[model samples]
Target: MKPHDVNSTVHEPSWQIFLIFLRLGLTSFGGPVAHLGYFREEFVIRRRWLSEKRYADLVALCQFLPGPASSQVGMALGLTRGGYPGVFAAWCGFTLPSALLLIAFALGLSEWGEALPDGLLDGLKIAAVAVVAQAVWSMGGNLCPDAQRVSIMVVAACLVLLVNTPLSQVGVIITAAIIGTLLFKPAMDAPHEALPFTLSRRAGAFWLALFALLLLGLPVLAGVFESQGLALVDAFYRSGSLVFGGGHVVLPLLQAEVVPTGWVDRETFLAGYGAAQAVPGPLFTFAGFLGAAMNPAPSGWAGGMIALLAIFLPSFLLIAGALPFWEALRSQPRIQSALMGINAAVVGLLLAALYDPVWTSAIHGPADFALALLALTALSSWKLPAWLVVLGCGGIGIML
Candidate 1:
């Protein structure tokens, strides 16, 4: 990225910048974690928007926060790289395809919720176990390479697993930050993975406020119209906004909302989740499966569109709301300390997540354990591309 006096350089045109995000949204494959790799490849490695260290800092911050880390990172990257519109493009591009797919899935599932009883979805759950376990192994070693950070990871894992609290995530991150600052640890911040532009503090707050208002008000407006659109909006918005872990974590919440409404069924819901793991980009696209599957009160494609749009809207709004203000918050020393701790906690939380729901639910027996071992070895030793591992394993899953 060409350097400019923050005040003097003309920003990239919004449409052109939007195209970059759109391209990322369309082409970036895998779920949120994989998406992060893809994002680094594009914006940081390819575009050079910021050094790798800066990008890591941002990733750590988002990981600590409550929303979708990948989407938030993407939008924050955009806001820094371009501006408000940049954030918009990054979000829209990232969210749309999966949303469209989930809506379609929803349409079909609405009529077919109870067709099967076997744990076909079990395969995906198992695969998720492998993926996250691998993620924990891979990230744990790399991110928490040092002894202090390792200690932070341990404390975080115990807190979440033993005590059972989300604050554990916050605690570990804050702890790591204090340690990192005092020790001047995590010495390698990497280098510029991307470049950045700053927004006025006022502009940042404005975008966030606007997003919050829409989030609160849109459903109300939709209620006024007596349209089903509000339900879809609330579901997606809440899924994108409230969940902290990522696509996998977001699943249960999304299912609960759609399933109880009698919108989509259990079998189909699992099917979409399974198929989503196999698909590229954000797992949130499970929405696309759900959307396509839905049958609306009014009927026809309108329902599908509503479901898809509603599900994805929150991700976009969140990006808009969060990205603009990130720089100011990240710059403060204490806040930075807090985020560092939070990042470590996020890793710990991820660790706990891998064991209980993921491994236990996924690894049924020796065969499943063997497969997971294979995936971990493939990830760690063979160092194959993520997509290759996913596709090959997915093929094996279907066969098994």
Candidate 2:
């Protein structure tokens, strides 16, 4: 899968792309960082869907956007491969497994609360630590080779670790862009080919407009109709729209919206959250669980569907809105430099996440530490497939 083969010559069937993403949806665990590992291997390395430079650029684009970064990246990759239908296929394949599992949990979640063995889940988390460490190492080598960029990566990691908030992510990326602009002036002057836009800029503008209109109008409609479904839409949509820094960062906004409004009780909410950790897709799929488990009429599959769509809709719209202009926006030398900085900062963000939620929560004892090292060795050196490593870790965890 060479870079040139993907852009102009190669044509992967939508079904083939869907199946690949579906496998990823079912098998990918360990959060966004781990998902990138799986994607880089499957798409960039194996399939050659895009070049490493293009993939990195796509990642850098998603980092600054306010949606599930992994999902958005998958969708954008899909769109690049096969246009609009490909976009839907990519999202569906990647999102469905966890959405269905969480929805099932929502409907009958109380009957068997937290049924997944805690040890097995812990093993998955430990596997995540190793996976993320690998991602940081690989991406750091590619994105932060020089001392100055390495410094940027370190500071970004430090800032996120210290502040541990979405605002901090925004700050770091912004600061990186400013620094990148100044520091990368030399690199920007180098000749570079422009990337082709997948869709018209007018189409992109329309999507952005629609996103804004819905962001503003949905709440008012919810109030006027006084409808639970509409309110659910409004709440989840706002959660998707407002939150920056995907993954765990979206959790608090969601907690605030549903728990306070009595859409879901605290116990049910926490249980679903726990379940979400062990699932194989984006953490945002917790929306599906919440929707399916909500009190009153919205507590069923339909509700779950609504929530899933609401939470993910913003991501689709943003991706649709952004990708068309990306080539033009990024072609500027200053913008290129800034993106370089932001790319380095993204590696730092992944590092911070790896340490906190991934490492701190998983590596609790010497046994856990040993297991993580084993998993890391398997992945990095032994070259075991990621899914196999995940399964092996779970088996080991059960034994422990």
Candidate 3:
């Protein structure tokens, strides 16, 4: 929907947007990095929910903040179009499909066969490589347009590889936002997502209340309700609320939540996590993976569903509530500097994440490295479809 369409634009009703994101939630792939590429394709480049610049600002902001960057970005993207409720719908839609699949898959891990159907997982991974490569290039073009900005990315990349920092992703982007604002502050006359003031404000408040209720009252409610499902939900939701970087951070949090409890074994958790990296949407989908796979009380697909929703709900609320405020705030010189520093720091964070988790997990041998290089080449130069590459790679993976 066009921005001017009061009825249809980004402010799309919660239910309506739920469906759109639902499809995307299921299909988006390549992890956090790849998810950005998919998001640009669906929302910025194709759907025109917001302008490229606006989307960049939103992305940069989320990257700098301490949270799941992609999921936060998704929530912010929806907010840009529709406000608080828009954020709610986008998250639900984006989160649901994958959560459901992962939860279901998790429940029957033993029965899931030695491997995925020929070429499926491989294809997804290849597609992911392509998608991330594309995002790297595209973001480079838009964000690193200036020589100075380019320097920031290059330096940030080095920091990530060199420092071996644990949670420096948040630091990288925050640093960039600050630098950007200080050195090259821009005017704020640029286009913005149209918004409805009163409704948006009210919706924002509602989201906050919902989040607070879940956080404070949930434990008590769970104990009374005799629902370990509530405990899982609380755990996941708290994880979502506390993390300071992207989805990978969820690993330690989730491990702490489930492992000591003897729910899923180490192997199962690792395997599920590795597999999750290949799926689309948020890394938090791992909630589904564990929720179903573990045989905890009330665990199964049902627990998986509850866990998935609980974790993502707060993101939707916080993002949407902040959207209206961000439009004006981003234009401020102070905010701009902060954003510049933040974005630069985000580059560093991405660099770190790419190495520690994404690269190490996926590329095991020379052959795997070669395949990854090939996938990157396809993404960077050929513009081949992500799905096709992923399919081809999955075939190779099973065989290898």
Query: Best candidate, lDDT-wise?
Result: 2
Q: How many residue pairs clash in each candidate?
A: 52, 1, 38
Which prediction has the highest TM-score against the true structure? 2
CA lDDT for candidate 3: 0.64
RMSD of every candidate to native, in Å, equals 6.3, 6.7, 6.7
Q: 208-271, model 3: which lDDT tens digit per residue?
A: 6777788778778878897777777777787676554457555655665676568777556655
> Of models 1 and 2, which has the larger lDDT?
2
**TM-score of candidate 1 versus the correct structure, residues matched by position:** 0.65
| Whole-model alpha-carbon lDDT for candidate 2 | 0.78
lDDT of each: 0.62, 0.78, 0.64
Q: Candidate 1 or 3, higher TM-score?
A: 1
What residue runs in model 1 are displaced by over 4 Å at the alpha carbon? 1-19, 30-66, 76-86, 105-120, 143-196, 210-239, 242-271, 287-328, 384-394
lDDT of 1 by residue, 1-400 (tens): 1223122123566677777777777777656777789888886789777677877877866775556678778777666755556666766777766556555545544566456334445555565666666667666765666776677778877876775433334345456666656653223332343225554445546656766787678768777887676666666665565555455655545655667577766545655665565555566666656656665653335655555555555655555455446655545565545445545555676787677556655677887787767866776689765556655655666567
For candidate 1, give the lDDT: 0.62
Predicted structure 2, TM vs. truth: 0.67
In candidate 3, stretches whose alpha carbon ends up further than 4 angstroms from where it belongs are 1-91, 113-184, 191-193, 200-287, 290-299
